[model samples]
Target: MNQFNKTINRLGTYCTQWDFVKDRFGKDDVLPFTISDMDISTSPEILLALQKRVDHGIFGYTRWNHPDFKNAIISWYQKRFDCPIQDSWIAYTPSVIYGIVKVLSVYNPQKKPICFITPCYDGFMKILSSNDYPTKTVHQSLDNGVYNLDWNELETALSQSKVFLLCNPNNPNGYVWSVEDLTKIIELCKKHKVIIVSDDIHMDFVYKPALFTPIIKVAQKMDYLDNVVIITSSAKTFNLSSLGGAYIICPNITKLAEYVYLLGNKDSLSSAPALFITSLITGYTQSEAWTDELIEYCHQNLIFVKEYLEKHLPTLSVTIPEGTYFAWVDCSKLGIPMSEIQDKLLNIGKVAIMDGDRYEESAPFLRMIIACPRSKVEDGLKRLVKSLL
Candidate 1:
């Protein structure tokens, strides 16, 4: 009778996580747990809203300037995180990475290496590398599975860096940044005159006892309004990534202008997609309970991963995540080299999990995405253990 137990066939849907497994991992036959997007269904409410929009029959150029779009964003932050942002402060982007790259190009036109914590998102790493931007990382330390930043190292990196990039409730392993953590990061970045670029897309999936604090909320009181910016979307929150809607909240007037200019004039992506805007408003305004259920299901999936690995594959280790649906498993105990782990997994285990080094993590690990049905979670775990054997 569990609502989340329902399975949906995802293959033949051009799903990157399912159909493009061979394109990414060189193995088409394997079950994939590499991409961070969900395998679970989005809110039925959102699907219905999109259908209504489709039925309207006019797919003309859609503008996101309406009050509803901004109000939905404003109310979501206010209700969920107690954050209040001006409607005028919000601007649209095609995706989070699109916003980040625009900010980087405008803010750090010199392309100097930006700084962020280690075991970072592979997407960020790939983007930085693709732009030939040198990056400096201060590897996070662990205190009972919670990722802790080395403050001294962070300060040192910030002192020399132009930007401090963050994926709040960081990916790979889900470490929700406490308010204290956010405060300290803001203080260090402000002290060094560096900008904080945070990707807050995964904020909604945090479990209880661990709150997702947006860096913008923490910096709202500070004098450095121009130094903080966050790019996020309902895409990650509502399984609407394929729909293509993202936005930026910048307190800096000048940089915000530049971002809009880059997006509208330079990139010529002025019009927002109608379906994406509909999805955003509907998901934020109407589908909150759906999000709550999603959090519960994902948290349970992570716990299952931790316990299942401890029981069946003692050599593998996973700590239950505090946020997001990902389980970053430590496979160093298996004595498999980073280079050969995926080969073994694909050929032997018939599983496709991302290698930790792609995120520049120090030790050997595998990042498994578990935002799917319980059956897939169980089957994927069994496959992971088989790969190791």
Candidate 2:
């Protein structure tokens, strides 16, 4: 078996995905495929680096200004995406959402409403609402099992909003944006004078024939770099979320200063922990092979689910994601209400999956995370089949 197929117990680690599912749903026997984090362990190189840091046993105020740290990030982007990024363009934040909220608050001085492509990462909606920021959603249209951006609706929304939050390799449906698609979005945002803040945390998980194009690259190509910002992290790629380190890449130096000033004022945002820095450096510098293997495993899992559904449940539909480890399955044809389908999955099927409504307008769909051991994926599918069929 590959390293990914090994079932590692995460129950006692205070894991939100496994440990809190029972408390959240009041069910102890539920198998959760809800949270976005992977069940697999992180890279061994990162673990070793972290252990070395622990051995030093000195925890104090740290700075992320080291050349090695910045170079690791720069080298990764250059090697993987063929994009040249300057060290000065990079800044640190606690997480991708933190950087986004900061950008939304500081950059939008006029307080124009923000817009995002719908069926997005649910956290974006929560963060926007919590900040009381007005929002407009551009819903993607599904055709032939793929999700396509509605440029007409998007332009209308962009005209009304000052900032557009883009989720490349879109969540729920996981369609990696094409260069052409991104070029169109850049043109639209540039025309409307809207700032583009792209959350590209899943940039590393893209599958073949579906490339992950950084919005900043598009901005640079169009000489509209000042109008764009990118929020990303190794957290999603290497399971380093709890480490709480993310990078905000701003090509425009003036806007970069604003972000630095705003984050500098917050005492909590002083610097990332040394462990996080170590893990990040190791992840970018030494974990490429591990990430490639993980992506292949996830792709196979996606194929497994699609084939299983086609064979056993012909009436149901599953969207094979171009990126990310999620399988968005449509349950509309099951003849059950969305709420009831969610209930049956939890109560009868004993599996916990995210309802489509959480991402956008309510729909008869469920998003299942397949970034776990093959056995677990098989188990979850069997339970889903038993309950729905």
Best by TM-score: 2
Give per-residue CA lDDT, model 1, range 231-312, as digits (tens): 8888987888888989999978788898899988999997999999999999889998888888898989999998998899
Q: Candidate 2 local accuracy as lDDT? A: 0.87
Q: How many pairs in model 1 have backbone atoms within 3 A of each other, for residues 3 or more apart or on separate chains, i.e. clashes?
A: 1
Clashes of each: 1, 0
For every candidate in turn, the CA RMSD to the true structure comes to: 1.4, 1.2
RMSD of 1: 1.4
In model 1, what lDDT does residue 166 have?
A: 91
Per-residue lDDT tens digits for candidate 2, residues 309-374, read 999987788878888889988777788898778787887889998888888946578889999999
> Model 2, residue 127: what's the lDDT?
92
Give the Cα lDDT of each candidate. Answer: 0.86, 0.87
Model 1 scores a TM of 0.96
